[model samples]
Target chain A: MAESTEVKLLGLWPSTYALRARIALNIKQVNYAFLEENLGAKSELLLKSNPVHMKVPVLLHGDKPICESLIIVQYIDDVWTSGPSMPPSHPYDRAIARFWAAYIDEKWGPTTKAIDAVIVAGEGEEAKKAAVDKVYDILVLLEEAFKKCSKGKAFFGGDRMGYLDMAFGSCLGWLRFREKLHDIKLLDPAKTPQLVKWAERFCEHPAVVGVMPETEQLATIEYGKGLIAKVRGANPSKW
Target chain B: MAESTEVKLLGLWPSTYALRARIALNIKQVNYAFLEENLGAKSELLLKSNPVHMKVPVLLHGDKPICESLIIVQYIDDVWTSGPSMPPSHPYDRAIARFWAAYIDEKWGPTTKAIDAVIVAGEGEEAKKAAVDKVYDILVLLEEAFKKCSKGKAFFGGDRMGYLDMAFGSCLGWLRFREKLHDIKLLDPAKTPQLVKWAERFCEHPAVVGVMPETEQLATIEYGKGLIAKVRGANPSKW
Candidate 1:
């Protein structure tokens, strides 16, 4: 338990994946050092810690490193049991939460990257519209999920912000930034009113307040452009 | 607990994903009805049970359904606590297990698919060799992982077969099938001695014995060719 204070996180400020870890740590009230990683020239510690992926955010709990964002979030929930549980209490509910979290990562993450690719390439309006439609389609399903998970409560964790909230909320910044840059409304209030309200509550939560980067800040860092660049560089055919 | 007897699984005979769930259920001694899903004409139960992916295996405990193979395995482990644990006991160990499981799914699955595609297309020997080499490269890494995870024990779960074991073990049939059809050695003993030995033990385990299909059975079903056909039909460009 004493080594809990020795926790360190390797992350990039702009990464929504990294933001998930920070938000979870804040929720658990786990004080930890944050080390910024430069993707262009990854630190030796980051490489050594997560040799497989070599991707942030890697949570160095003592000398042990946990990679992948959602995995790290679950790890935090597992290790720090004193605070509000991140995943649901029941096994069935946990499975459902995990299902959606994976859905977001697998479906939403790639779709978001596609949007970024389209935007970065300054593709035709038709392509842009198609990309935007894909995101909206996903959000429509997520709105239904929010209703089911929250059970008319304020957040996905019911009374508090938990796993699903952090999983989805981390993307809000980039979503909002994309909207601002393109003058589009991905989270259409009329179409997904509950999610809009939930998004408001999620952003305002104490654990999430300072953790998420603002839309303007994302624009300043050219996050969408940089992300697509890195992704394309890694796999040219993907984007 | 009354509903524990009401367990039902929707899966295909040849799917490694589905096999993971079956092995876990067998390990836990959970008596369950197996419902075969025809991918060409998916049943209404499969569709309704998992509306999102509409893929197998779907584990239905009473009326509740859990989709995705690994998630189902973990759910079985969670709900059926009397049996041996599937995932490792410690939180860090659990994270490591989850990490490797995801690796197998993300990396190994695709590489296997590439090999299948090359074989089914009757591609040139050079293309086939390249695909086979990719799988061998992944196996080398898994061999090292086995050493780390098993810690010189009989299985990844130490004395018993656990999460990582089932995760990788499910694919043994297909790996063996590829080796047989191509007259090559994918799990080369000289290259990945630990994995080669571990695969043998995994196949012989009580939980996995009847669950995993024989390589001959896989060849009989034309699993590799059929798999590539499905993959191509779903996403023409991926394979």
Candidate 2:
């Protein structure tokens, strides 16, 4: 109870990264006040807390702020040792979890951003379809990873949701949103049956329910639309 | 002793990432076989060890292979608990160490690469000078980080060469090479006096003494030149 005091989370509702911090906090059952930051006019606390990246989900535990979603998640798991461990117990398992989390950020994250860029820019169908295909290809790799990591368990954390689960699961809302907007099935059952099934259980978890922003609601938000529009107008090569 | 058995490192001598694994092993006093890989014709061992990135600096502990330099370093530290801890002990300190290490990779790493592109491409004085300036600017930020992390101590790890030191120190050879090749003082003592001193001590440390490739020798290597040449020829936007 002493550790939970003064816990605050600086986040944007539509950010998958922010969702990660929220999910981790919820999983740990730590009481925290969520401080939503406006990307357009960021609060001083947000900017000061994360001066390096100036990006959100900054978890403020007392006066100290931990930035970077995955890092924050790890910090939560480290300090809140009372809860079900978010990171795997073994060193090698932890390494593998770190590897895939990095892959998701470096590879899958960019592909999704590229898809957003293409769709928002109203690019030709070929370009949009190609972007979607790339996502599926990456998902196939993730599916294999899930198989290896889960070892026939229900979650990536085996009996319960853990680090890798939170890492990938945060993107479920975006995947759902993209699927509806583009009229495409991203988590194709055939290609990623394991992930598709895992995703369902993930979203339905008590820790996750009502946490993710609704896909329909997300699509209507100017924040989401404006963010995508900004990416669309950015240098295409960046995507 | 059991964990040390069958330990092997797949690496390229010139690579800073590979250098990290070497330094960690040296510090931990772990006996390991160094298997040099030809980047032009990568060994099947490395190809299979890191199928995802197909990159150098894979640490094989028995049959399991650990990829990613930082992850490998952490894994080495985690397994060899007998040695001086590489990562900071306190959870918050560990988070700070990780944050700065990541900054080194994502930000400082790219700036250095861009400088290599400009210098290798034989770009004009203005372009090269701008690249060098960018590097110095990053150094200034790192200098600030050094001050805060070291707390007036000798190294980023305080009393000993630890994670952040290893992360940034691995690049010393490249920094030295670039300085000599470009006839520029990249780590200006005036701007980063603490880092300049820290760099000297880091290089001279018993664990680090011969692990880093000599700048003069690195400069003469075809491997180094060819790698920079490839970068020079790549799309400028990538730099």
Candidate 3:
């Protein structure tokens, strides 16, 4: 056997990415030490370890530092010893899994920025409109992803929670969080109904349900309201 | 073999990423059918094949399209059943290799935008200054990347060109092209001497040298005096 090593998760409590890592570890049945971070006043260990971005969900295996959430998830999938597989095995299947994983990485940023605008933009009518447009765009994309192609599959890969599901777990948290904060229900059953169903099934999907973030973590999103508003107010041209 | 299949490459001539796929194919000694596109009037096959991005080089093996330049490189790496390895074998080494590949993807847009400013914004004093500054910022980053880390080597991974070198090959063609357009040397031996050596060696590297675009390609940059005037006249904010 290769050397056994300690696994430590350095994460922000409310981060959906952090939650994804937790669910992945639980799925692989790997026991890990969890360190909750104060994102505002990040620890010396965190700062020293991840000097490049200094972002959250830094998964440490032994002495090595893994930054970025999706990369960490991929690493976990690669490193898992005894596993009921997270990524698809065949070349085409693996390509599909990676494509969707890359898809989530590509879209999640713009979608969340949209949601942030909906809840955070204070009477800034233009920002509000942009936010609505972003949400509509994301919801439509999510709708297309679920209700269209691969419609019959339980997950992106049929009958299993593959890499795509883990990539998208970020959105599920944001969907619920945004609905509460913005006082709007974007992921309504009428629009993206299949996705809503999938999100529910995903929430209860054994490994995910047991280790997912509790409802309270969703509340912390309001902190970004002020920050995002400042960014919106600042003219991008000046930069 | 899963099925006997023909390999095809759909690409634009001046594109560096397209050149990347070309180099990888040459290195693997894989015989592939090449179809160059007229971007203004794209081919039906190109549209039907990669409807999403409609960009290239798209690697089609057995009728399956593998889009994205780096992903195509990975596919080439996987399919080159009887060729020399491009990336290292160790998991940690491969992790570092992937780190640099991913880095290039993250930096492409921002770096290219900055480079575009340098090439086209030459008409006004302020515009030229901004262009020079942008080039300096990228140069600083490349210098840091070239600096001796724990490995005591200059290349992204020591001794040999790995994933980073291959990924940077895309940037190299573009840089050389930009240098020609601007008529101001950014990566001269005087300023960035180490990087200058690295770039020279990069051009001469066995794998990279084979499919490199002609020296004349560097002379024919995609810019003009009209572009310079237009960039100078417009607000730099859009850039």
Which candidate number maximizes lDDT?
2
- Residue pairs whose backbone atoms clash in candidate 1: none
Q: What is the C-alpha lDDT of each candidate?
A: 0.85, 0.86, 0.67
Every model's DockQ: 0.76, 0.78, 0.31
Better of 1 and 3 by DockQ: 1
For model 3, the superposed segments whose C-alpha errors exceed 4 Å read A1-3, A115-153, A183-185, A188-193, A214-216, A221-239, B84-87, B118-160, B188-194, B218-239
Ranking by lDDT: 2, 1, 3
TM-scores of the models, in the order given: 0.91, 0.92, 0.81
The lowest-lDDT stretch of 10 consecutive residues in candidate 1 chain B is: B230-239
Deviation from native of the Cα of residue A117 in model 3, angstroms? 3.0
Q: Per-prediction interface RMSD?
A: 0.6, 0.6, 1.8
Model 2: per-residue lDDT, tens digit, A108-187? 77897788788777787899899989999899999999998888999888888999999999999988877765668999
The clash count of every prediction, one per candidate, is 0, 0, 0
lDDT of 3 by residue, B1-239 (tens): 42357888999766778877877777677778889888889998888877756888888887888777776776777667454456555555556566656766777557655756554535566666676666666666666656732165646656766556677766776676455545557777766777787778778877667567654554444443333444545553322
The DockQ leader among the candidates is 2
